[model samples]
Each structure stands twice: as structure tokens, then as C-alpha cells.
Target: MALAAAAFTAGCGGGAPRLASYVSPQFGYTIPHPAAWHRVETDGGRRVWFLPQAPPAAQPPEQTAVDFLVVMTRDDPGPLPEIDVRRLAMSLLPMHGVSGFQRAPRGNEEIAWYRFELTGATGGREWASVGLLVTGPKRLHYVVCAGALERWRTAQKVCDEVLRGFVPGDLSR
Candidate 1:
């Protein structure tokens, strides 16, 4: 299944690039990303980062551009209610300097998930991001897709595609 997922690619016409699926056996989740993106995993698969193929040439050598998608998972004490999940998502906003925050709830009665769209400035650079927080039976999953403000349109497209393809692991396990 991993090999098949790795081999599968979806082409987008009119100059749009193709994408490939990244399946993490350790985490039991899958995310779609551009073929050229660089992937990094840490904390025993608790966190994963995906960066562009290369930093922009105009970027200062000392300051690498902060554009990437990150997925993080942590063990929760137990199941949490929708209100708690929403509060948790709201709490994360300030930490990221997030503004223009908008939230949308997802999932059925068994799972509590919240999605947020926000714009923020960090290190003097403006950026935009889409964040998702989900509460499972025993764990919480968070995914953040962000990019530079100037390139937000293109970034948002990729972010949308990534979100659409994201499949969380079986939290009941």
C-alpha cells in the first residue's frame, strides 16, 4: 500500500504540478504533497514538516523563509467535547500571532474537529495559514498549512489539496 501510494501521482493541467501521497506507517496517516517538497519528521512521528523544494533565491541566507506545512499529534487524556476542542483551537491563535481568525467545525458526533483560517505576522513577515485540530478517542491531531502572504493564493491551493487528502490515523487504537 505504501509503494502504491508513493507511486500514485495526480496531474493538474494548465501548468499545475502533480502531487504524491506520503503515508506514515508509524503515524498511520497520509498527506498529499508536491513531489518536490522536502519532508522532515521528528519526535517519533509526533511532528512532521514539509518544506518547499528550495528556499527563494531572494531570501536572506541567514533567514530561511518560513513557509511549510506541519502536522502534530499528541496523546489526549481522553475524549473531549466540541466546546473544549473549539477552545483549544482558539487558544492556539495567539501563540502564532494569528489574526482574521475564522473557525469551521467538522467531523461527526464521535470526533470533534475544528478548522481555522488566519493571517499573521511573524518575524516581520506576513503569512497566512489554515489550521485543523481534531480530538480523537485518545489523541489530538493538529495540522497547519502556511505560506508567505505574497504567495498566499498559490499556497492556499496547495493547502486545500493537502487538507482534502489528509486522512487521520485510527485514533481508537
Candidate 2:
């Protein structure tokens, strides 16, 4: 598979890190992430996680300032109702303290896709996430990028970049 290089700057202003594409051979989807981040896969490639490197020692270990992205897919049983789709998306998120739910502008008319943003408290830490659910012909692609609310503005930029670059389905094959 061919991986394209892209430049991404996290936070306000600093040197941009080069990004590399990650193609899921098993699932047939691809996304780009900063080269410095670590990748972890589980559930036989059904779920993938992109985690940033360890934080500086100056940061308190207990300070749950987390930033990461997770991509997951499951078999889709054809198209679903709008309410059902919204329900499915909400079910994937934290059960409590969720708000600011709004559907993102649509793109790609062929497949049923929903993009949204929400904030919620999980594990006593507030987080902001941008999530996408694409009901493809054969699979339901769910991608979410989240970060601590304290740094949400910066994290949202990176999350948007990752979400925009995401392409569902196996394009490499």
C-alpha cells in the first residue's frame, strides 16, 4: 500500500510533525496520523487506537489530559433509519454528561454517513470528541478522536485533520 506524507501541527504554534497513512489491510480502510504517535490494534483488527507519546515529566501524572483517536468497524445490516443511526452513534459514547450534539455537514452522497461533536465526562475527566459513523455497503465505520476539554481547541484541530483524511473501505486492494 502507498502511504502519503502530510504535515500536521498539534496545539497552537509549533513545528509540524510529518504524518503517515495507516491502511487497514484486514478492514479495507485508511487514515493518516502523526508519525510520532503509537498504533495499537485489537479485536482482530476490528478496533484500532492511535496514542500520542508519553507526556513531559512536568505534567502531573494524575492530570488526565488525554488525546487519542480510535477507529472501529462492524458488519452493517444495510441502511438504517436516521433515529437508529443517531442512537447507534450515541450508544458508542460515554453514557453520561453528553451534550452539544450536532450533525456535521454531509459529504459523499452514496453512503449514509453522520458526523457529530459532543462533550462528556468519562472517568471523572471531561472530554470533547468529534465522531463519524459511515454505514457502508458491508460495514459500519466508526471513528472518534477525543481529548481532554482543557486542551480541546488544539486537540480539535488534530481531530479534524484525522477525520478529514479518513477514507472508509479498502482502497489499497
Candidate 3:
């Protein structure tokens, strides 16, 4: 409900980004993302969009895509239930390596995180995850992350813009 933007090292350059407004009423939120980027829906029917991870290549469909999590549940009020969102994420990745993520820093409204690459074929994959963790009513914590190599340096601006654009709606009311 406030203007607390997420911070991370996902790279993209241009003027202030205006993300497209989310249409589905399921998410109950919307924000401005950069124009031109395409929103690719996943097979399971979860709303997904491109985060501009890599330059367009002639083949291989762009090794990866920086995507956002559930759209409707953007403002999850939790004492965080026994939800296995992490396990669900792991099942999506190629059946090769595992990721060991850890808490790196904590701020008043923002908690920065880091991911340790445990076993993977891709080189330099550790990421710092910056997201909003809603503790309860009016208590939302923003977080940011990136590859351990250049965590803060690379994600400074993009993290700010994305997190600031976060919006949530009241479902129970």
C-alpha cells in the first residue's frame, strides 16, 4: 500500500520504467514495468513476465528469465505459514543442481538476501533476492538480492523501482 520498492541486481537500463498494469482480478494489484518487454505466461497458468535477463540470442530461448512470484498473493499476511514455496521453485529448475540461499542483511523496511550456488552447471549463479515480506497488516518488509559477485552494485536502481511499484489489495475485507 506504500511506496517501498524492492532492490536487486537484475540489470536493465533506460528512463524510469512504467510496468504494464496487471489485468487479472486474481492478483488484485498492478504496477508499471518497462515497455517493450514481453509478459510470457507459464504452462501452469501462473502469470509470468520477462525481467530482461539476457540479450536476445538466435537460439536456446534466452537461458533464463527473471520472473516474479504469484500475482494475486502479492500482499501475503503471514506469521509465514508452513508454505513450501521454495520446494515449488526447485521443482521448476532443471534437475541438476541445488541452491542454498541465506539471509545476508536486514534493514528497517528492506532485508537483502544472497543465494549460494550449491550444485549447478551454470557459472556465477548465486543471487541476492530482494522482495517484500508482509509480516501482517501495515507491516510489509522489502528485500533485495543479486549474485554474490556484485550484489549491491549491479542491482541498485532496478531494485528501487520494482519494489516501489508493488501494490496489494484487501481480500478478506
Candidate 4:
């Protein structure tokens, strides 16, 4: 988590770039991502997917250095649970094979949003990542933004933009 935060801040001193909207008709949600990123549908369009544009001259152009996903969850009764970002971040360590896991210091405190950071092996390589968990009135939303540790610095701004711009839909409709 420390590594991911450092990478996020290192190259993200300037303001975030423009974003493009991604809306889901079934779920009625809308989120923004970097305009340069490409969208690819999967799971028969049940899920939303976006991949960051690799920097010029990157060794493997096809390598998904950074990616984002918006996932919808089942409806539940009662009030939403207060998500402990620190505990939540630590909980992912075992599942992601993360050796060092920590939650970044909180920067924003939205009523429905929680953020986390982690490092783990993916595709035989180490990745530094961040994720946002959001709760809507009728359902839960999860957004994961991750990139290779080496290139995460360059990808952080886009990740932040996407997470911050997320707007969940009106599930009651």
C-alpha cells in the first residue's frame, strides 16, 4: 500500500485529465474513465471493463499495465456496513497473494466510498494496486484500478479520476 501511494503521488502532481463516461443500461450507473482508455465488454456485458493506454515504446504493448472494473452486487437488507478501509485492505492479502498489504491514509470521506491499496503477483509479475468500494441505496458497487508497480506512478491519476467520477445509478427504477 505504501508503494502504491508513493507511485500514485509521484507522477500525479498535476490535475487529472479529461474523462469519458461509461454507463450501464441494465444497472443504470455511470462512471468516468480516461478518454484514451479502451472499453471491452466481457461476461456477456454483465461487467464493465477498461484498460489503460500503454505508454509509447512499451516493451509489450498488449500488456494490461493498468485496468479498471465496475462490479455490481446483490441487494441486501438493513443499513450498509461501515467498511473499515484498513481491515478491508488487509483482508485482500491472502486472496491476492499480497505479501505486503496496507491501506493508504484516507484523503476523502464520502458516505458511500472506501478506498484501499495492495501489492501482489499477477501474470507472474508484481503489481501495485488501489480499489474503491461503494454502496448504493439498493446494491453495492466495486471498482478496482491496478497497474504494474513500475508503471503505476503514471497510471495513478487516471485511476483516481475514474474512481472519483463514479456515479451509481438509481436502482429503484
Better of 2 and 4 by TM-score: 2
lDDT of each residue in 18-86, candidate 3, tens digit only? 445554454344544444445544433334444433324542211342222222132434323313334
RMSD of each: 7.4, 7.4, 9.5, 7.6
Q: Between which residue pairs do clashes occur in model 2?
A: 28-169, 28-170
Please list the C-alpha lDDT of all candidates, in the order they appear: 0.64, 0.66, 0.35, 0.53
Worst 10 residues of 1 by lDDT: 1-10
Clashes of each: 0, 2, 20, 0
lDDT of 3: 0.35
Candidate 4 or 2, higher lDDT: 2
- lDDT of candidate model 2 versus the reference: 0.66
Best by TM-score: 2
Report the lDDT of model 4 for residue 103: 29
Candidate 1 local lDDT, residue 144: 79
Top-down lDDT ranking: 2, 1, 4, 3
Candidate 2 lDDT over 1-173, as tens digits, reads 01111213442245445567999888878898877777776567787777665434564222322466778887866445567777877776563434544444554444676787867665587777887887755567888887777667756777888889988873122
lDDT of 4 at 94: 24
lDDT of 1 by residue, 1-173 (tens): 22212221224543334777888787687888777667776567777777654544565311443566777887874457656765665554333454433434556655666677766654576667887776778777788777777767767777887888888877666
The runs of at least 3 residues in candidate 2 whose Cα sits more than 4 Å from the true structure, single-residue gaps closed, are 1-16, 54-65, 95-110, 170-173
